[model samples]
Target: MAQNLMVCQFCETSNETKYKCANCDLILCEGCKIKIHTKIKKTEVHQVLDLKEFSNLSASETIRHLDLKDIQCSIHNAEHCIIYCEDCKLLLCAVCLLESHRTHNLTKIDEMYHRKVKELQELDSKLCEELPFYADLEKELKQIKSESEIKEIITKQRENIITELDRLWVPREEEISRQLKDTAEYCDALKRNKAQNEETFQSHNATAIFTASGKLDKDLPTRPANTISKQKILFSETRIPEDTKEVFGSVLTDPKCKITGSFTLNTEDSIYKIKTFENNTNILSLTKKSTIKSFELKHSKCNTTSI
Candidate 1:
């Protein structure tokens, strides 16, 4: 009814209506209502109420509305929707009310919303019952696939890990090979040096040779000139570490190059000096020599030194 509307019913001109008449079936503007209703003596006592209070009262029981200010009507773009069609399931504007949905069953948007909520609850129950079966079927399919591919997966993983390990170990293997080649070359050089030294010593024989029987060699009573006989080689002694030949006398060669001389270690100079007497009783006629030698060291961190 126009009573629920904001415009004054008497003039229908202004929307700034602040007052209305509750007893009568009429609404009035601010100026007209004040002049005719409040100030007039005869109708002054006529129980009149403001339009705001009248709006708060219930206009009708079946009448309803919806917030449709933003929703444009598809039928008329200039109009906004305020009603819903129950048969076609669409929103309707004021023009649609007169022309399109004149005979169609139209409803307020809020009532339609309640009806749709009921349908959604029924659909949700059906979904709740049907979704778990699909989920279980999906899980079964995934399990079958995983069981079939387990062997291939493990083999691929093993191959990948081994390839990575080999990649990391390549440098260490190269280092080992290089060191082995260097050691083999060094040993070959040392063997060649020893062979050369042995050849020189054998070709140029010693002139003065002493035996264990305290007898000296003579070339038919004319002795050859004595010179340095042996070349000295310095290295750590490992097989017999005791420094004294008496400790292993059982294994010593008694008559091999008999040394009829006294040997002493000169610790201050780290050298062994030997004194030889020409005759057993003549301590004055002695020959002394320091057995000192220089050698090259081929030590590396790859192995422990051994002699």
Candidate 2:
């Protein structure tokens, strides 16, 4: 009986038919497949095309043969050259000198292979070291972006707080000012009413027999009481009075933070205070440094004052 024969694709070994590049018509053994064909520069571009796809090409396109006769030098037309320039990828005869390569240093293909392999290995090692740095940079950038986003959100929130506080202050301030003006007008009205009563009393007294016996001065009014009653009295619900603190209502601190107002008062008993605006809460209290002097009566009557 005859033994069955099988060819190797890479080493031309007929020992086994385990691996084959059928499209390229090459027989390869396992060792030669990895060590020889796969490592070669030219065959590296050739893929393992399926037989069906390869068969679709015409015969002229499928097969490529390098004719040694065509390997003549363009300069001298010499044949059978042993030397070749791997960097330039060209054949060179003995007559071809090194000066023709310009500044390029000429070397054998085997020397180039060793040099290239060593350099490629070193470059691969260096690239491996720098890969970690690239990953670290990417991570840092992501973290920085995340922190910036958070800060932006916080800033927006602070702006909103300021806006809200401003809204609350506008109308409230207008109303308070209006009330103050109305209070002043009411005080004036009271003064006028008292003046009218005093005039009526004086007229009645003049008609009477003995109205001003004690006041001999004829310049004084017939009635004993003055024509006008000053209403200067002001009372606070809390003994702790308000301050320039009220003006601070128009003034604002960080609305996102807390607000406190400070003030000084000139009165019979001087008062100094720092108060919280939100709850009308007093933070401090103090008394006058000197005695308060009394002033002459005005067109109105009421003595105590509060601010």
Candidate 3:
């Protein structure tokens, strides 16, 4: 069997390589070596080597023999690049060299290509060295971002709690204020009537006392219907596990009213007047027969005695 020869670069069909053009970096068959390689423009000075000999040479040796004089200038398309300008970092033809880069540092194109390759290798090494530090910095930044998000969530929850508390309590506060005003007004009226009766009694006139007593009975203030009740608004906190995923703790409110004390009055007559004092610690009652009774709350039970 025949050995697997390298394919010709020019025709891309023949599998018999005989020569290699160092300048164009192409492998050619025997027929294409003479016909095709010669047809290309500016190949008169290109060093064509035997395929086996070219393969035997080191990479640096092959590059040294490679001709770059035929490389076209980008700006002056028809002219060929002869040198590379170190300052401008561009390939220049003769005309370009005279026009703009006359005083700039210049070198051969192959020398500059080697220098550029070395610089790229150094830059790649530096990037590899700093990659771990950048990765750690990115991780730290992400942790900070996560902490900030949690703080924002907690702050929003706090604001919502305050807003809801205000919504629930504002109307109740207004109701309490109205009850207080009404109670004050009722107390003032009673004081006026008492003052009038006391003045009448101090006059030492029996007729005046009899006439003022009927007026005082008519002017007596009635008790308010809607009295302010004692209220205790409490927030019962819920304990959360340390490992729980929840961001904040929760609270509960008891809706049912608690009965603190109870009383029983054994009165056969109808009890008309009832009054409580000192947070429901003491109570007074008056019946239609002018009978008075007093009670005191002790240990959640009521004890009464007649007066």
Query: In terms of TM-score, which candidate is strongest?
Result: 3
- lDDT tens digits, residue span 136-168, model 2: 444543343333232332334345444554464
**Tens-digit lDDT track for model 3 on 7-40?**
9989999998888776676788889988878988
Worst 10 residues of 2 by lDDT: 226-235
Compare the candidates by lDDT and give the number of the best one: 3
lDDT of 1 at 262: 45
Clash totals in order? 0, 18, 0
How does model 3 score by TM-score?
A: 0.30
Clashes of 1: 0
- Model 2: how far residue 143 lies from native, Å: 3.0
lDDT of 1 by residue, 1-307 (tens): 3554467776677676776554344667777786555665656534455655544412211111212233567779998777778787677889988886889988876566445434433433443444444344335434433332323323343454435434533453454444434444434443443343323222211110001011211111111133112222121223345765522111111122645454432222432432334552211111243333322222321111211
> Local error of candidate 1 at 79, Å?
2.3
How accurate locally is residue 295 in candidate 3, as Cα lDDT from 0 to 100?
71
lDDT of 2: 0.39
Off by over 4 Å in 3: 1-6, 9-14, 30-44, 49-66, 107-114, 117-307
Q: After aligning candidate 1 to the native by TM-score, how far in Å is the CA of 109 from where it should be?
A: 1.9
